[model samples]
Target: MTTHTPYGDDPSQYAELTLPDGAPRGVAVLVHGGFWKPEHDIEHAQPLVPSLVEAGWATWAIEYRRGTGAADTLADVRAAIAACPVEHPVRVAIGHSAGGHLAAWAATQQVGLTHVVSQAGVLDLRAAHDAGLGGGAVARFLGHPPGEADAGVDPIRQVPLAVPLWCVHGRADDVVPLAQSQAYVAAATAAGGAAELIEVAGDHFDVIDPASEAWARVLGLIEQLGRPAG
Candidate 1:
């Protein structure tokens, strides 16, 4: 069974917690992406919780206020992450699309996150704005063009993350181009950050589907990140 916990007074500031059958090896914080819109809620990520649980991991599927602005959305993500159980030895933040941007942005904060996985994330807000993704979604979220110096929220601008970053993007992703992940990973690596980009065969949604091969690869990356270094 899954339990829903409210992180804030707003109805959107809640998270669904799912536990494994046995002891959990770690906790996976799942953030859904819908170009930062209300239409895409945590329910879209529910299908992934069971798989994570079955993999011996506890899951926290977060729902945050969207379409408000980047600050509010980020605040909700931070609050939800803070609400997670800290006793878990390993913590990973997994997000798709806009959520991927949030996941990567969260890593920049001192949130005690061990790893971050961005699936088809719009890492480069500036580029995304220029590309006219989601019909000016970036400008709407940031309240201005990318040149306004909101590097704090822009994942690509905030390169060389403290935590290890795993960027998985579908080559055929029409929603968010593959170049977003590729460029971000390259910049992170160049800036002396630990990052890797995995190109998969699928679309933007395929990376989030629990049954898709892209999702299986995401699970594999999570497992790899959970392992202790020699």
Candidate 2:
């Protein structure tokens, strides 16, 4: 795992997992989420790095500013992608939990992205806050009341960036809830965005458990996106 310091004043950091071969099929940037709390960083997704690399894709394990004190993780994600070698186009953004929300947001900022894979993503920030997920780190990340989070940063309310979005959630996830992904799909589709929803069997962390069958299913989504669009 090769680490790279972001090109800004922020203390944000990131790392990369390159394929053994010379050129990569594409780049997959993994964004971790602990409801945007400072306690959880990108390292949470480290276990899943080899999953993409083994599939011929280079991976960038991202550690963006988490709390309200630092820059928005959304901005950090954009900077990290911008810093990536232009030659290796960003094939997709795979974000888990809050990172999933960020990935969905990042997909809108770029034009050539293959797609966005949201793993247990937060489609409605306000909903999470309202449901009391925002009491701790989540509240700091969103910088507002639960109602504000629902009405303000809701991914559904934002303009669709026109990239294909695949939202996956564990049918039994209690922390982020499966309904979040469903709501996001509904909003994305209503906004004319390309969206796909998959209900896998697992809990919050199990969704990223590389050993679980659910992990393989998520990678399948990435592989399908890597192929040339018809």
Best by TM-score: 1
Model 1, poorest ten-residue lDDT window? 221-230
Candidate 1 residues 111-211, lDDT tens each? 77888999999899999999999999998998888785787899988989988899999999999999999999999999999999999999989998898
Top candidate by lDDT: 1
For model 1 the local lDDT of residue 96 reads 91
- lDDT of every predicted structure (CA atoms): 0.88, 0.74
Q: Model 2 over residues 71-123: C-alpha lDDT tens digits?
A: 46667777776666535544788889888888877776663456788999988
RMSD of each: 2.0, 2.8
CA deviation > 4 Å runs, candidate 2: 1-5, 69-71, 134-138, 146-152, 227-230
